[model samples]
Each structure stands twice: as C-alpha cells, then as structure tokens.
Target: MKKSIQLNQDNLEQIGNHIPVPNYNRTSETADIVHIGVGGFHRSHLAYYVHLLKNSGEASSLCGIGLREGDQNLHDIFKKQDHLYTLMVKHPDGKIEPEIIGSIIDFKMGTTDPEAVISQMAHKNTRIVSLTITEGGYNFNPTTGEFNFDNPDIQHELRHPNDPKTVYGFLTAALKRRRDAGLPAFTIMSCDNIEHNGDMARKMLLAFAETQNPDLAKWIAKEVTFPNSMVDRITPVTTPADIDILAQNSGVQDAWPVTCEPFIQWVVEDKFSNGRPAFEKVGVQFVPDVGPYEKMKLRLLNAGHSVMGILGAIHGHPTINACVEDELFAKYLGAFLDEEATPILGPIIGIDLEDYKDSLLERFANPNIKDSVSRICSESSAKLPKFLIPTIQENLATGGCIKFATLVLAAWCYYSDKQADQNGEPLEIIDAMQDELHKAATATSSDPLAFIRQESLFGELAENERFATTYTDMIQELYKTSEVKKLMRSLL
Candidate 1:
C-alpha cells in the first residue's frame, strides 16, 4: 500500500510523478488578478487556465478574495496548502487526471477585513478584478432586471460606505480609491453563469455608484469596462468521498481540492478596460460576441440539467448520471433538447447542433462524474428562470409543442409540494422562494392553477389556456399516481 502524502508546497517534491505538481516558483510570484469567489468552478476553470500559462513560464498569477463567511474555510485551506490544490478531471472512460494548481499566489477574506479586500482591488498592479459571485449575489431584481437598493446588505453599504460588506460595496469603494489616486480603472470581469454577466455587473455597480456619487458613477461608466463572458464547466460540490478517493488513487491528500467534468470552455468578449493576460494562448476563446454561444449553452446544457433534476428527485434518482442512464428519462431528455431547445437557438457559430446535443447526453451519462441531483435541484427558482423557462415561453410564442417543458414545471410543482421523493425520503430543497413555492405548489390541492399563477415567475403563462390545461393535468396525475418514470415514458 502506498502512503498518502499531505499536499502543500513542501510535499510537492515528495509527491510522485503520477499526480503532476506545479513547476512554477511561487516565492517570487505576484498576482495582478484579484479573483473574488474562489470556489470549485473558479479553481477548475480560470485558475486552471492560469496554471497552464504559468507552466509555460508565463508570469501569470491571481490573488483569490472571498466575500462571504463561508469562504473562510477555503482561505484557511489555501493558507495551509500554500495555495496549492489538486484538480481532478474525471473523463467518461473513468480516467482520473489530477494536477496541482499554483496560479493562486494568495487568498484573502473580505468578511474578516473589508479594507484589505478593497486595497487589493484598488492596487496599481491589479489589472483585472474578476468575480465568480453566484447568481444571487448580484443584488438585482430578477423580474425587473434592476439593482435592488432596498436589500439589507445594499442598505448597510449605503449607510456605511467606508466599511464595506457586499461585493458591490467593495467594488465601488475600491474603484473610487483608484479614481481618487489617479490610477487607471481595472477591468471588472464577471465569470458567472448569467447571460451578459458583465452587462449585469455594470448595471448593478453603476446603479450603486449613482446612489452614492454621480461623479463616481460617471467615472466608472466612462473609465471601467465590463466584458461579457460565457464560462462552462460542470464542477460539483466537493465531497469527503471525492477527497478520500483522490488520496487512495493518487496517494496525495488534498484538503479542498476541486474535481470537474472533462469538458471546459470560456468564451470572453475582448472588451477589457485595462490589460489582460494572454488567456487566449491557453484555450480561452476571445470572441466578438458571447451572446449566441451563451444562449446555446443555457437553453441546452443547463436547461437539460434542470428538467432532469426536478424529475430525477421525484423518481428518487440520486445523481445526474443515474437520471440519464434511465432509458425512459434519456428519451424524454433527448426529445426536450431536439424538439424544444434546439429550435429556439437560432444559429450558433462553429457548432453542429446534433453533435452538441449528442455530447450533452454522453456527458450526462458519464458515471465517473457523479454530479448530484440535489446540486442541480437546489435554487430551482433562480436556475429555472434562466435555464429552462425561456424555452417554454419561446416555443409558446411560435406555436411549437411545450409538452416537455410544461411537464418539467409540473414535476417541479409535484417535487416542491411533496417535499420528498417517491420513497418518502425528504429532499433538501434549497431555493430563495422555498416557503412561497411550497405554499403555491401545495395550494394546487385547492386551486389546481396555483403554481402557474405566480405571475412573477410564470408571467401570464398560466393565462395561456393550452399550457395551463396541460400543466394542470400533469401535476394532477403526478399527485394521483406518483409514477414519474412512467409519465416521462408517456411523453416520449
């Protein structure tokens, strides 16, 4: 039996060659990119790209900054490991590729010291201040698509601007400092999943700035550049089992290592305010527009995850792989993509729609990547609107069939209402509108149209006679029979 070695800067030399360690010298490194939200996706995607550049002897580095208290654990882990962590890429064929990433030179916590966070972002050398703050962190009204000033965090920041908490507060305070110091504004790049993420950041930041100081907002609008980007990589939440498995396989014990699917893509619009790294040199796509690419991905890959997720939970399928492996589920999923999603996606450059759809099914069925159903099922309110809902609306407008999409929502209603799987195992439903959704879903007992009547979410879709009738029938049958798989087979 091989002895497992603790992963850190010192242990890199002792760790065997099977697991590749970073050859770059960290002692003399300086990070010019301040990446906020140092979670799994960032580690696997952006940091991995930087690691490639670093391996090729480019002086690329990133200082990771985490805002929420939840980020503290990663900060401590990075400190202990000297910002060195393994990235295990699981291929469909059960191949494990592990590499120690050394692109992150340091990690900071905004929760512990906001001033230090601001200082780093405002630093002269920091050319790019990137964000991976999740969908909810934007502090915007999803319906109105405007920054919410009434948010408690936004309000707190407005009251005390100097001592900041939220990303908006930190960014505004930092950009103001750079402006006051007569320094060039750093490019505010968003690496989140939202379509036109950079545009959203600019909207929210400018809104926050306008409230604080018109002149500062004007400066930000003029001087700063927010580049729209589309990032794709399925990085599941790391598990203890993943950690232990990586150790047993590679004989290297990593505390907070990240593992992801084999596929990775980054389509960035070349709209940086200041200088940026030669990310293109390391497989980052610099496109004229990321809109089409993003739309294609969201409508297909993400939407597929959502539909499968809701139904998977109901059928007691624990992971995405399990969901796709089911013949009935796979048939319905393929139908949803081919008939529903693909038609709406106008035309994506350099992509074969059939091939892309095939790849999606293959990726979903990869047993090595045990992407959890719960992870996909979490935050249904935020995710469904962005990923799946638009397909339903678009198809509805064109007189196309919405049976697949409608059933997805109907299943979601059943899942939210039952609050458990077919086996009576309670699901950990994580959503911002959890209570409200449950109330609405359960209210269907009295009012069959309850869930669809959420004008905020459904937006008059309930008024559409065809959709409302179909959804009503599906949810009713789901309650009556509780046979999710049988229903899916009927659809196909």
Candidate 2:
C-alpha cells in the first residue's frame, strides 16, 4: 500500500512550534474579497495578513477567491488540504519560519467556466477585488500608463461584454451586475508592482468600460474606489529543495509551496468604497498618499534589482545573493544605486536614502534567499522604463553622472546577444526585443555606436548625442574586457 499522507493536528502543532501558523478561523459566512492572481507572493504577503485578521476574531467575512485559467491543479491541491498551506519565510540571518495560512476558501478556473467567475463576481457579499496579476496581464502601455484597447483579450472582452472573455471584462460585468442590483461597487485594489498601480488599474478598467457603456463608465468613475499601494518582498522561484524541506518539516505534500525573504513592506491609500478587512492590525501601513513610498521603492529597490540582475547574469552568477557577495559586482551595484539612482529620486517622506541603500545591500546579499538572475531578468522591456530609464532621464536632464546608465544599457545589450561564454553555457534572454536583437547580433558592424542607433531598443535616446556617446563608449569598453568581472572592475 502507498504511504499515507500525514497531516494532522499533531503534525501541525509541531510545525507551528517552529513557525507561527495563521490561527485564522473561517465562519460559514461568504467571502468579501477576490484576489485575481493567486501566486506565491499572494500567499506569502496578502493572504497571510488576512489570515492573521481572521484569527484575531476580526474580518470574519473576509475570504479569498483564487483565479486561474484552465489549470485546476492549484485548485485541486488547495482543496485536498482545505485551502490551507504553509508559507516558509527565509530570513537573512538564516532563520526559517513556516506558517499555515488559511484565508483562501475557494478557487475558480475562469477560463474553463466563465459563468462561474461571473457568478462569483456578481455576489453581493464581494466587496473588494484585489489583483496580483503581473505587469503584462494589464495589457498597458508602459509610457502612457493607459489600457491598450487593441489587445486581443481586451478587444474580445469589449466585443462580448456580458459573456466576458478577459479579467477586465469579468470585472466590468460583475460591477454592472452589482449596480443593477443596487449593491455597492466593489473596491478594486491592484497589488501589482507597477508604479501608481491603483490609478493605472482604474484608468485601464475605466477605459475598457467606457468603450461599452459610457454611463456605466461614469458611474464607476464616481462610485468605485481604486487605492494605490506599494508592496515590497523578495520572493524567489520555488525549488525542489523547498519541496523537500516542506515535506520533511511540515509533514505535508505541497505541490505549490512558497518561500520568501523575511522582509515585507506594504503601503496603501486609506480609501475603501464598500468597506475593507482590518488589515491594519496585521502591519499594513495606511497612508494618505503612497506616492513618496512608491517612488522610493521603484527607484531604490526595483532599480537596484535590475542592475544586479543584468550584471549578475552576465557574470554567470546564479542568484542575487551570489551576485552581491562578489566584491566587484557589489561595488558596481552600490555605485549605481547611490551615485546614479539615489541622486535622481526626489525626497521621499519618512525614509533615509543612505539607510535604505544599506538595507537594500543587506537584502540583496542575503545568502538564504535564492532569487535568480533569470527570474529578475524577465520582461526587461516592461521593467526598464519603470526601473532604469527614469533615473537615466532624470540624470540627463539635471546634468548628473551617466556612468551607471551607460553600464546598465551595455549590460542589457550584452545579455540580449543570447550567446554563451567560454564554458558554452547559455544565457537566457527574456524580452520582447528578442527577434530584432538576434538580427542585430548577425550584423557586420563591430562599432557599439552603430548598435545603439537601433531605434527599437533606445528609441530617441539613441539620437541624443550625450546619451549615445556615453552608452556607445561603455559598450566598446565592455567588449574589450570580454568578461563580466573584468568589465565591472574597469567601471569601478
């Protein structure tokens, strides 16, 4: 006979002794919140907070709806354990805390049965609809911060609003249902990492809604609440090692286990339309304005990640910790953040830039967290504007040093080559610019100046003499060094 799966109160208690499990209880009452992307981050951050609130005998009405497509595997896994899972927090000091979070009560695969999703959204009890759907899911124009209505998914949803085909469509349909039923419009909280996420979400949702019902759009504009939020946590991709740890320590088989760094920060605008759960009790910072905090995080934390990611990948470093441990790479990252990125970030309220930079270095150098360069390297096209370009633009306008910007662009160009070094190990190039990059790689010109002229990557920055000169010179220097370590050292 197969070995019996072992998960009981005893085993749970043993695990809880080592880590704190969320002592949240679920009443027979229905859910008040629906989270769109039920990924690792959601489990580690938002769900854990909600679970804490529920455990403290507050927000008993709050529960979660995990949205997925055709893949019911997650749904099946959660159902097997009564929608409960252990979240392991890996601290920089080598301490591990595992917690069983139990806020999520239901899972729905909207792609398989759209009607089920629509019905769930139409529920009168649903007051908050939050999302962790990554930047790409929004179908937004990075520069304009507007919904790309021409997106096939958005187009399909627009054409068939009632029988909705996308997330936005489902949301619009659900709100219309609520409006018709005389229920309050649910607050839409975007927990994504995008800058001004709440406003961006509102704009996109409203733009899409306007294309269908102008009056409905106006009503939503007046009634619905979209609260801006700033979220920070370093969540690495789950590995086999994590699975083994969970199985051995927690005595549970979790196919989708989540692991994260100990540090987590969430800042939200103090606004809710249909009321909200008591998240404040669980360390969520409620601020009148999240802009300063958002700017601090976007420029410091995110920008720092991009710098480390590109340079680390080129250096053949596997993880962020490894990259930061290397003397040469660490110096380059520090200079990029402090000298280049920090100077451009205008004054942020209640934050010391130097202290934040030091904390960032410590986080990036945390040996326990294995955040891979490849994970951070994905969607460079989408990430660059938000994380890197702003600093570059600011520095250029203010006549500040452009060395870091130059090196960053060069590192990105090198990463796009899709060629391995002396060991023949391949570098993963993840970006929308892949095809054109490949074409450029085969070109006869060895001049770095010629490469930057490619409009697709640099746009008008290529024509700007100051930027072109600095970027081109750095690329040539990097090519001469031929090794990431040496290239980084030369910059230092």
Candidate 3:
C-alpha cells in the first residue's frame, strides 16, 4: 500500500480521494473569528460552517485559541498539518463522508505564549470571539448562577494583573486592550450547552472585569454584545481507530481528525456589536431570540442524554448506540419524553414536538456515530443541574408526571455509588465532587435522601414531599434489582 500523504496545503494535490478540499487561497484569507476551546465539537460543527463560508468565496476564517495547560498537542498537530483537518460525517444509512476543513487558518496555544493568545483576541480584524468550553468551564455556581469569584484561577488573575490563567482573565485583558487601542469591541458568542449561555458569559465576564477595573467592566457591559446560540452535533472524542480509518478512506494521514453525526444545527440570536458574518447565506439560522430552540434542545436532548448515559452505564452498556439498541432502553426514553420532558417544553416555532422527539430517538440510535455513554456520563455535577433539574422543577410547578425525571435523578445517584455494572466491571465516577458524591450515593442505599440532601444541588426542592417520595421509591427499586433495563421497562 502507498504511504498516505499528510493533510496540508502542500499535499492537497497529492490526494486522490473524492473528499472536497477548500476552494479559497489559504495564504490570503484572514482570521475574522477567534474561537476559544478548539475541541472536536467546534471543529465539526462551528468551523465546518466557517469552512463553508470561506470556501464559498467569503474572506473571513477562524483562528482557534487554546489556553488550557495541555493544549500543546493541538498546537503541534495543527502546525504539522497547516491547520488542515478532516471531518468525517457519519450518516444514519452507514455512509461516512470525509471533508477537509481549512477554515481554521491559525491556532495558537496559550501555554507557550499567553500574550500572543491575548493579542490574537485583541487583533483589530477579529470581530467574533466564540466558545465551546463545555459546561463546567464557565466556573459559575450551579445553585446561585454567579461567577465563582473564589476559584483559585480567578483569584490568581485578580492578584496578578499582568499574568492570567482563566478564560475570564483573558477576555477582560483582551477587551481592555481593544478599548484602549480605540478598536471596536468584538461580540462574545457562547456555543456551550448551558441555558442562556450568552447571558451567562456576559454576566461572568462583567463580574471579572468589575473586580479588575470598574471602568473597563462598565465599558464591556455597555459596548460588547453577547449572542445566545443553540448548537447541536454529536461529535465524540477522536480515537486512534478513527484516525486509521480516515487514513484509509481519505488517503491522507490526519494527525487529529473529527467525526460527527451528519445532522447539524445552529440557531444564533442575530445580535453583534461589530459587523457579523453572512452565516445565514449558508444553513445557519439567524433568529431574533434563541430561547425557544435552546430550551427545546436542553430539555429533550440533553436531559435525555443524562437519562440514557447514567442508566446505560449502570446496565453495562458502553456506547450510546449500544444502549439505545435495547428495546427496553428505547421504550424508557420514549416514556421519558412523552411523560416528563415534553410537558415542560413550550411551543417552538416551525418545530413539531412529536417529530422532533422521534428524530432524537433516531439520532441516538445512529450506529455509525459511536458516541459513548461514558463521555456523556462525565461531569454530572455540572450537567444534571442545568439539564435535568429544570425539567424536574417545571414538572413540579405544573403538577405533571415526575416519575421519569425522578427515576433519572435516582439513576444518577445510584450510578455515583462507585458500584459495579452488571458485567461486574466497576464504573468510574468522574465529577468535581467525586468523593462527596460517592459518600452520598453509598448513604442513599441506606438513607434514600442522602444524595439530595446536598443543599447546593437539591436545596429546598428535596423538601417537597411528593418529589422526595418518588425519588426515594426509585432509589429503593434500584437496590432491589441489578437489572436496570428491567426496572426501566417496569416503569414504562
């Protein structure tokens, strides 16, 4: 077999695969958007759109900002490939389409040069600063919804003005530089799954700036625009097996590849301080308010993930596809939506709720995209409050069926017990509050209210007799049966 050529501008002509390459001249294009947290999802979903815009004769492109400690790997890979990477889109019918994404014209790791990262954001031409820094990256209190001023990095940034570590620090410093240089403030767009993500970003950044400089804080609050967006795509962490497959399919050895489901959606609130991209020219939705779409995705899809990921882990299911393949699992998810989740969601424009729910089941059952249950199971401390608890709360308010939501909360608590799965393999409990969660979960086997008693997560909500009873009964049921599938089926 011929040795596969490396994915780069110089090697584009050497490739023989049918995968489309960028049409624009890479050397001439400028970075108009600087994206933070350059992970798999952003590359697959957001940068894919930028690739479309750039390839369709648009001048703007994206430059990723990697500030985390271990970002050197990303820097090295992008440098090796000239910022060119392949995205494998897995369709439901088992067809995998590979496309080379070149819109990410530049990428800089802040670990080596923090100042350069700041400068990139402060650059005059960069109009948009977007993020996909996951749920926990925001560092906000789940209960209070306030920026964690007491976080060590935030404290360090506060003490030392010249040097900084956190994203909040970087944004504050960059915006300050831009303001001083008489450049217009860039729009801050958050693509995270958190509800009201743009609003959260604005609040946190403003809070950070207020501590550093009250004037700068006021300027950011008045001048900058933060647009809320709803982004959906199932892009899992790239594995070695995926890389070898990309090599075979594309005949190009990509150092770091991204694989995602073919279904992609982005709904952005059409608000920007500076001029924005003509993203609407492509398939991006430029809506007046992203609230409805955001709510729908978070409640139905995200909460459903929580339900499946945790329950699936307990039942020894590895990947999401494997979990959804079970008839009991599928039926339980259907009941979850029909009984609990759907009732809480308001009417979304142009969306038939029933059809949307059906599509979600189909997407989850996509065998080609092997999104893992364990991946979704990570960071439950941050995720459950934002994703699942809202539905619980609303269900309580409306006097709706809390059975399925209660079961999900119970599943999470039981899964957190450091207990072994059905196969006798120990399930890894990963969370910021790992030890505490473990202790609480162990206690819940004896005292059902132990986990919910944590005031930060459950608070006064647990004090409600109806929810408390339902939760306790479900936990009790878990203790009786190692077969979670049977339990869920019984509930259905």
What lDDT would candidate 3 get against the real structure? 0.87
Over 1-492, each residue of candidate 1 has an lDDT whose tens digit, in order, gives 457889888888888466788888888867889999999999999999999999988887999998988899999988999999999999989898988888998998999888888999998899999999888888877667788898888888888999788998999999999999999999999998788889999999999999987899999999999999989899988999889988898888899889899999999999888889999888999999999988888889999999899999999999999999998889999999999998888878898999989999999999989999999998888777778878888888998889998988988998888899988999989998899899999999888899988876777888888888888888888888888877787788
lDDT string, candidate 3, 123-185, tens digits = 999899999988889988888888888899889999886687888888888999999999999
Higher-lDDT candidate among 2 and 3?
3
Off by over 4 Å in 3: 16-18
lDDT of 2 by residue, 121-156 (tens): 778888898898887777777666667788777777
State the local distance difference test value for candidate 2.
Answer: 0.77
Candidate 1 vs candidate 2, lDDT winner: 1
**Per-candidate TM-score against the hidden true structure:** 0.98, 0.92, 0.97
Between which residue pairs do clashes occur in model 1? none
Q: What lDDT is reached at residue 124 by model 1?
A: 89
Instruction: Give candidate 1's error at residue 485 in angstroms.
Output: 1.9
Clash count (model 2, backbone only): 0
